[model samples]
Target: MSALNTSVLRPAGFILMGFPGIEHLQHWLSIPFTVLYITALVGNSTIILVVKFEQHLHTPMYVFLSMLAFVDIGLCTAVLPKILEILWLNSKDISFEGCFIQMFFIYMFVTLESSILVMMAYDRYVAICNPLRYTTILSKTLVCKAFVAFFIRDLVLTGLIPTLASRLPYCSSVCISHCYCDHMAVAKLACTNIIMNNYYGLFVALSILGVDAIFVGFSYIMIFRAVLKLGSKGARLKALNTCGSHLFVIMYFYIISLFNYLVYRFGKDVPVHVHVVFGVLYLLIPPVLNPMVYAVRTKEIRHAFLRHFLPRKIDSDLSHR
Candidate 1:
């Protein structure tokens, strides 16, 4: 019994199902997934490079934006390679250690993203509510400190879920039903009692995502209030416009995540493919859209992009003329 239990606890590996019910479609699905991965890589990398090289973009807001791009890159990179392999090559085997490592990084990147969003909200709040002190409040030193705080806070908090999960005695089937290593999904495969895992996962999810969302919402409310008190219509529009990208990002991240959580918790009757598809969407969509949202919606980013990419075209056109 003891040897049997040990063997069960430490299985060889897990088989990740890319898209369970639609195996035939995985090749087709890989096309879009590959496109999204490339887009996220190129887009976020461009943002980071722009923020790094452009002197005018050395401000706190752009600094945070660059950090967000960095996070998106990490988030997508953590999951996409394995996903693409599973989809395109049918290589779904992941060692237990590999699975835990992936789980850790995925959760870490997600937590960092949530923290960055909260910091962005605070940055906006300070900029709009106290423009005079904005520079003083979110100085380079403060931004550095905020970055450290975000890393440490999320590292400690979100790490708990994956850490506890890794320690669990997984005595059941060594198969995960989704593309990547989701904490809840993996934990659910344990044959032993998983009430602790479930409760703790819920706690961490709420503490990070739920609390961050509430704070972000509150920050926006304050921003709206400040905008309303502005005497001119143009001022209100300008303020709201500054927030448009961040607000859209916040909505995009949280809404899909919330829906995924709901389906995970309550949609047992729903089709497995639906859950898998939504899971993929939840992970992939933000990374693909975030940079686009910022670039298209933020005037500075648009200007920077145009300045970076259009000059060569313009010079070519001039030479032709």
Candidate 2:
């Protein structure tokens, strides 16, 4: 199988659905992403390093943060280089196998990430709502259990689902308009009658994405109930304060996910670039932004940043002075 590009929509179709903005970007868009990526790299790498070095951050929340940063690193590494390479060289020529591999890891990391967030919510809920029982609730045993659950679920979603999906035989154009191996992209290229394929695709999507959404929602529901009962408004605010980064990450992921599904189903005539642009943002932003948001929001991370980076910056400033 090989990748090829053909317009999925004719002019009449274009008029109805309009263009999806995946491939469309101003020259300036790359500049911000460049800065954001460097920020992401530094931000996430620092989180990893701090967690590894600091005895104080050995708690469950920081452990989850560490895993989340690692996942972010994996996610960015998977997508960013290809994106930068393609943008600079104008080469989006991903091979059939290479595309599938990309999809597998991206899928794996995304699922893993969702699970990590769930673990973090549980960690925070225990910390805020059950201060005395927090250690018992989120013990070392329990954290390891959570990690096992994360990877097990991750494997099922990314590996099992894609394995079955790939076996169906790709009989269409191999050129995945977007960067990675999306199920819909491969499904569209399948040579076989794809009714069964589509069914499986939707089924798997609903299972992984659907189930994770439910868990995160449930965790927050419990958290909110606990928050509402706090006598002090300040206490309630403090409880929610930890959720800020997580909420941002979840909102970012789900909105893009819903947009992608909606565009694919309803906006068939949208331009390839439109789809490319949004998908690229969706894939890259959370991984990069998550560390920055979390670090900025929390004292521990802020202190870590200052302890780690500020001294270097200060030294440079003094050198110039």
Candidate 3:
């Protein structure tokens, strides 16, 4: 550790430049963002509540779905509040500790979500391909282990990012060019050598999300193969239908995330706002969309919603009429 690194360990703070060129637009942008945050909160919370109260949803698939919803809520809560503050109140100053803390939860939940997707893919694979053995394979004990393993893996692996970044001496400008405290965005502000940080970040991204994505892809391929082999067309369609929601979630999460990652890594010539906008989208869209996707695509979730809330809605409507 250099003397400069030690001196700047506790620098003043960082100023988050929400939107540089269109500062006025940030307030306008808050409208949609606020809508998204509320939608994500309400949508995911509904899923969690439904899964908890609905006895029929106690299967492995819905257990994993509930876990995904919980992670979505954590992910949105980690970034959206600070972003709203920056957009609405113009309060962008974040202490060094605060920035790293936010970065920690953001990475933690993102990786956890990735792991959950992989688990969901596996759940679908077993249910569709080896239906007779799905219960035995994805038993309650195994599901508990899966959750513990992924949570620990994410905490241990993704935790390195913030831990390493926090140690770096940020002797340069403290103005971050984005709304939230992204690891790379904060790393770019450091004056010292960040080659280790950059490389480690890439390694973590590939090892966690990359490996999980590969497994998910392989699982789906096997699933499709099995589905195609079924003698009855109705059987094939039914099997594939169960997987629709999980597949859409995988595509939605990875597309925005990969786009943002590629842009951050290689799209240097791209405009700054473009990077910031996509980064925000990557964080925002999946949480907002995940529960809705499941609610629309999965029959049981819809029925659970109706079973729990539809009667109340009907009664209220009749009273008003």
Among the numbered candidates, top lDDT falls to 3
Give Cα distance to truth, residue 49, candidate 2, Å: 0.7
Q: How are the candidates ranked when ordered by TM-score, highest leading?
A: 1, 3, 2
> lDDT by residue for model 3 over 10-116, one digit each (tens)?
58689999977778699899999999999999999999999999998999889888998999999989999999999888899998899999999998999999999
- Cand. 3 Cα-lDDT: 0.87
Which residue runs of candidate 2 sit more than 4 Å off their true CA positions?
1-28, 241-245, 261-271, 311-321
Q: Model 2 over residues 1-321: C-alpha lDDT tens digits?
A: 123322221111101111125335533555776777777788888899988877888889898998989898887777777666655555566654566677788778877877887787777777767889988888899889778977887787568656766665553455555655566665666666767656665555567667777777777778788888989999878867766556767867867865664576568887776775676677788877788667677888776666666878757767999
Off by over 4 Å in 3: 1-9, 234-245, 312-321
Model 3 earns a TM-score of 0.92
Candidate lDDT scores, in order, read 0.85, 0.69, 0.87
Local lDDT at 107 for model 1 = 82
TM-score of each: 0.92, 0.82, 0.92
Model 3 CA lDDT for position 172:
70
Between prediction 1 and prediction 2, the one with superior TM-score is 1
Model 2 TM-score (2 dp):
0.82
What ranking emerges by lDDT with the best candidate at the front?
Answer: 3, 1, 2
